[model samples]
Target: MKIGLVLPVVVQHPSTRAEWERTAGIAEVAQIAAAADRLGYHHVAASEHVAVPREIAVERGGTYWDPLSTLGFLAARTRRIRLATQVLVLGYHHPLEIAKRYGTLDQVSGGRIVLGLGVGSLREEFDLLGAPFEDRGARADDAIRALRASLSDPAPSYDGPFYSYDGFVVEPHAAQVRVPLWMGGRTRRSLRRATEFGDGWVPFGLNVDELQAMLGTVDLPDGFELVLGSGRRLDPLGDPDATLRAVTRVREAGATVLGVSLVSTGAGHYCDQLHALRELTGQAGCTFDADPGHDRDD
Candidate 1:
């Protein structure tokens, strides 16, 4: 199975800034990403949040650099690792702009981009963004349609509840006709969305046994892709065999990628996690799958 690393982008609090400083900017992430690429990691992903529950205004994350922008920086620094979002909330940005942002990034990355999408549940963020939170799932499905059309076809036009546009055509079409879309959620809603539209499904925090059970119950589409991301810090999961077993189980359940969040209980542990995945990916003989493309000239 393919293995990817997730970066830490949010700031927890002022008191924790020292720990956060280790990861908080483009330069740091670029350094980390370079290491991952050299070590043969398959992808790196980011997360977006306006405000989270019970988060102190200061402790909560800042408006922060956008994911695509950070990804663009990573693209410039590395050639191999795919850039992606764990889930970029579709409601935060208009579908056209969202498509444009990713299309542009794909161009920069030379088509190495995977888009993990979701209609988020953070009601407060919607209130702050002036986007209606109700029926966001319906809105999300429409966003997916708009994104797909924008990436493919010429003169894309659409009419929908949350958005509509006419005569839309994005320049510098991606090298890959479709950007791999992964639906994010652990619930039934997420699973169904994945089966129906996504090239893959990324669900976080579940152990292999649990994932196996979940797979047995869900009606997965044929050849569905699964990416089981580790929840929490990476220290406990470093044992090579346990990690192998988890990824093995996920593969049998249809995972194409396994996202491991390097947990640093102390300092300088990220490299260890990278090495661990490198070994795992090597052993698995995971084939190189080209991600959805972007315009090289854009």
Candidate 2:
């Protein structure tokens, strides 16, 4: 299976974030992104959150760097690694807004952008944004349809239940003919949404067996990607045998791509872990050379 990173220093959850990340800055983040790019990793992701309620902040942690700004900066630093918004809340913006913004990013990154989107769940934050939280699932479905029609078209138009628009030009739109849409959530309905409206599914908080069972029910289209990175932390540096087993299990569970979170002490060690995983995956007979621009020297 193809491998990518659950990029560090972007979003720090209270339960899983390492101690060193408390003081890590954008410099460290860029260093890790550069290292992953050089190592032929598939992609790197950042999440989005405008603001978190104080009460929820303790459990969720409030340090979320904006995905667009973070990914935009990383785009200029790296040559080929695809930049992903691990998930941009679909209810937070109009579909055309996403098309225009991330389309500009796609142009900047030479078509290396993946839009991982979701229907958000935080009611208080949704209230703060003045976004409708009640029908967000339905809103998200319509938004996906709108995105599919508008992402690559300069003069785009769409008519949907929640949104309808026409007679406008989105200059410098997405470079990709069909910019990939990856749906994110932890529900079977989320999987169904991905199957219907997206190119991939990136589910969170699910185990290998759960993933297997969920995937078994879906008729995943050809080349449909399942990006899995739930459960235990990977330690290719300290435990290659176990890491290999974990990866193998994910593959067996029908994961086309692996979103890896490695055990590390700091930035430099994180880069080391990235290299170790690359080497390990390479030696285990997974193909990285097939990725476009992987062999580029410049």
Candidate 3:
């Protein structure tokens, strides 16, 4: 399975975040991403949260660096590794806005963009954004359909239940003909939604057996990506054998792409862990192409 980073320093959840990440910023993120790119990693992800409620922020951690701006800067800093939004909440923005913005990003980055999206679960954030909460699931489905019809098409048109637009032009539409849209959630319904509307499924909080059982039920399309993670954080540098076992287990659980978060003490140490994992993955019998794209103008 191909490995991708759940990028550090960008979105620091209190439980998983390393101490050094508290003061780290774009430079640190770029450094790690550059190392990942050089080491043949598949993608680097950033998550989105416009605002976090004070109460929830304590638990979720309020420090989310906006994915678009973060990825835009990282796009200039590195080459080859796909920039992914580990997710953008669908209820926050209209489909065309995503198309115009991220599509332009696709042009800027030479088509290296993976749109990881979710039907947001935070009701307080939804209320704060004035986004519909009750019907968000259905709305998200329509948004995915709209995105499919709109993302790479300049003169895009779509007639959906929640969002409908036609006869408009989105200049600098996605550089890739069809950008990969990976849906993120932790439920069977989420997997079903992904199978129906998205190119991939990135689920969290489920164990190997749960993931395996879910995969068995889905009629995934050809080239459908199953992005999964090991149950706990990996310490490839401290424990290579355990890391290898974790990687192997996730791969065996039907993960086409392994989403990883490493245990690190600091920025330079994080880079070391990245290299260690890359070498370890090679030993685990997982090989990845240097460049994820075949038709890039890089």
Candidate that scores best on TM-score:
3
Tens digits of per-residue lDDT for model 3, 7-45: 998988989889999999888888888888877889999
Candidate 1: stretches off by over 4 Å: 9-24, 53-65, 205-214, 217-219, 235-242, 252-254, 265-269, 284-298
- Candidate 1 lDDT over 204-259, as tens digits, reads 65666766777777777766668876544344345777666655655676677777
lDDT of 2 at 281: 81
Model 1 poorest ten-residue lDDT run: 289-298
Compared with the true structure, all predictions reach lDDT values of: 0.70, 0.89, 0.90
TM-score of each: 0.81, 0.95, 0.96
lDDT measured at residue 267 in model 3 versus the true structure, 0 to 100: 76
Predicted structure 2: lDDT: 0.89
Question: Which TM-score value belongs to model 2?
Answer: 0.95
Residue-level lDDT of model 2, residues 73-153, one tens digit each, is: 999999878899889999999998999999999999999999999999999999999999999999999999999999999
lDDT of 1 at 289: 36
Model 3 residue 23 CA deviation (Å) reads: 0.7
